[model samples]
Target chain A: ARPRVGYFYSGKKPGQDISETMNNMKVGDFQSIPVVVREDVSVYDAISQMFLDDVGTLFVVDKKSFLTGVLSRKDLLRTSLGNQDLSTIPVHIIMTRMPNVTFCFKNEPLIQAAHRLINQQIDALPVVIEQPEGLKVIGRLTKTNITRAFLSLSESHEL
Target chain B: ARPRVGYFYSGKKPGQDISETMNNMKVGDFQSIPVVVREDVSVYDAISQMFLDDVGTLFVVDKKSFLTGVLSRKDLLRTSLGNQDLSTIPVHIIMTRMPNVTFCFKNEPLIQAAHRLINQQIDALPVVIEQPEGLKVIGRLTKTNITRAFLSLSESHEL
Candidate 1:
């Protein structure tokens, strides 16, 4: 069966345009440098990068910092507890590879990005822009960013 | 400032006993083996254990498996990204020590545990039982557990 889409906001009025509502906000406004790790980095090093960056997800990049893949805490955890050595395992081995990643451009609506996060049940999104070579991951949008936006809206609406 | 509590359910009716709504549930019913790590274990090994467990939060246990503290991905990440060696750092050095942890008993109403998680913006709680020696980490309650219950309730309510 096709996975559910926009299931997170099923309570929205049937005629409403979620994308339209989200259009008022722009992805560029919320983007921040993503927690990143190299493809060759050990799973051990990747986990360290996550903790130091205070992020649950890390965007894997190439030597040129091109978007390569994504790895999350669960990925590192799975690779760590096994009988194998964590230092021997590279993060790229477990990352959700590129092209398969759901990403948003700098000007995309924040809500659209959030929808991808919710629908996929993933934590964050890599905000990228097309460069001559490929997609260079510029920043990220996370569920937390959406929540902050929601809170900001609610607070202002109450006023 | 004292952190906010019950803000997650501030919409709750003024006269309502939130616990009353949670009577049908028990922490034991929602508890699972929290991803765990030993206090003395290297931060590197701890990250490995997390991936193996498929859990976001890791309950720290002592030699006797008694609850000592909690380690989150953030904790490990904070310790990892710097020049400090993750392999040499023990988990306890970064764990949120006991008495500072937000937790609940197996018999506490599930709503109460859920409330603590939401109010504090924490990921999981170690379910414990008090013993003469100390608190024995029996199981865990996580946001995913609460989300599961919420989905179940919504489905039933619709029916």
Candidate 2:
């Protein structure tokens, strides 16, 4: 029997332009939309939000809506156990701050995005849009979402 | 039926120990081993090696094994389209150099690793282990592998 051809490379409408492949993909195509929280928010509130959202990570942003830091579930737990009052303490105090925090643009290819995650040994990344001043927080890319996209793509290829 | 417990809270084993928890976790685990070709290797030879290894990405390293640059299948294809004499062209001419490339350490947390991949917008990451002089490449983490790990963890949680 002949090997099966992947659906991704299969025939498309005659008018479809192949060079525009990336355009068809969206930011949501490979990233998990992380639950974001403001820097001033209490650690207690952030934990609750994470539990409710069923996500392992959260993006910490500033008043200007720019990404400031990231807070992982482990980080929150570690800080909470260290005698810090979750309710009284703001997320900014414990977050992995900027310069230390890494991010990606929303328009980038999924393959490129995945490479960054594995190379950096990071679980979650803030998705931003390039602005004249800098970058604006728009979404998030998580390990969970990347896995989902990979599986979906692989399955499509198998078919 | 009881609600499915998530991986974070699922009690597979007893007695919570932070050190043990960290040790058992495998976020920085690499699925693929990275292979590098020297600057003197012809692009044709590099492409052949990539195919023989069935890898999508290749690192171009120097004699010291220090990562100098990277080459991807897409990059090769584009380069081939412009030059037919790729057999004589060294890979260094078309590779994306070190300063422009992103990478990760073996000790980084999974959340951080995932975040970096998404942020950098790349597909494969070179896993490095710190040595006396500098970092040495140990393994490679790919989107496919991350997806597999995530799905497996999620499935285990569901079970």
Candidate 3:
């Protein structure tokens, strides 16, 4: 299913304003270049991508690099545990499809992205940009990125 | 480095209250039983334990079952990428040690525990209780657990 652009949240408390500090901070500032994959790739190749990229998650894209699905270590580990041949199994079979995947825009506030990551219980959020074709994968906001932000804030504040 | 219990956080933009909905929630209500492991276990055994347990993380414990360290796919994957022997390596060498690990008491607000997970870039938070010996891990709050909670809320709200 193609994921709708609607944001999935009710906020920590409904009345809460997006923190001024977070709203000022955008995803582009902290996001890392995403390790993209094609839906046709075998699961074995996806695992290799993870190893080579040193990332726990991968964003599956079409030939256009349009967002299609997402894959994580748990997804690979769970599927690989059985007797099935990873080489024969295509990524689309196990990948979490669009609309089901959580994503953020590059200009969006960091708090919104963090909310999705924590509330949705996903490891990373694919930073996507809208195009005539569809939502195309760009960068990614991961927990590690957020942790680095927190550490930077801590270090700067202590000064 | 040992992390203190101090809540190092600012308000959600100002006039916000800890989501009245989330502040009322407890980890005991949402946590899953943790897959436990021993410190002396070989890396290979730990990986096998992960397969058998069907979990991305394993709680490394001692004979007393008191919590000692935590292991996840990233840890194993990173270590195994090396040419060194996995069968000979002990789990204790790679696990995130206590006092350094972020944990949550069953009675703590789920929101607070979630903050630690996102801020620390960790995949799971051990739901623990304090004993004379140390903190004993009783259950675990994972991103999947949080996703379940969000889904439940979404489904109910829709109905």
- Among these predictions, the greatest TM-score belongs to 3
| Candidate 2 lDDT score at position A8 | 34
Candidate closer to the true structure by lDDT (higher is better), 1 or 3? 3
Docking band of candidate 2: incorrect
For candidate 2, the iRMS in Å is 24.4
DockQ, prediction 2: 0.04
lDDT of 2 by residue, B21-84 (tens): 2234465663567887888898778877876786667888888887888887556645544424
User: For all the predictions, what are the DockQ values?
Assistant: 0.09, 0.04, 0.17
Each model's lDDT comes to: 0.68, 0.64, 0.74
| Model 2, span A51-143: residue lDDT tens | 678666788877787777899765664554344456788989999998788788777765456567767767678888777765677778875
> Local error of candidate 2 at B144, Å?
1.0
Question: What TM-score does candidate 1 get on C-alpha atoms?
Answer: 0.55
What digit string (tens of lDDT, one per residue) describes model 1 on residues A1-38? 34223333222112222222335678888677787778
Provide the TM-score of the second chain in candidate 2: 0.78
Q: Ranking under lDDT, best-scoring first?
A: 3, 1, 2
Q: After superposition, how far is residue B16 of candidate 1 from its true place, in Å?
A: 23
Candidate 2 displacement at residue B110 in angstroms: 2.0
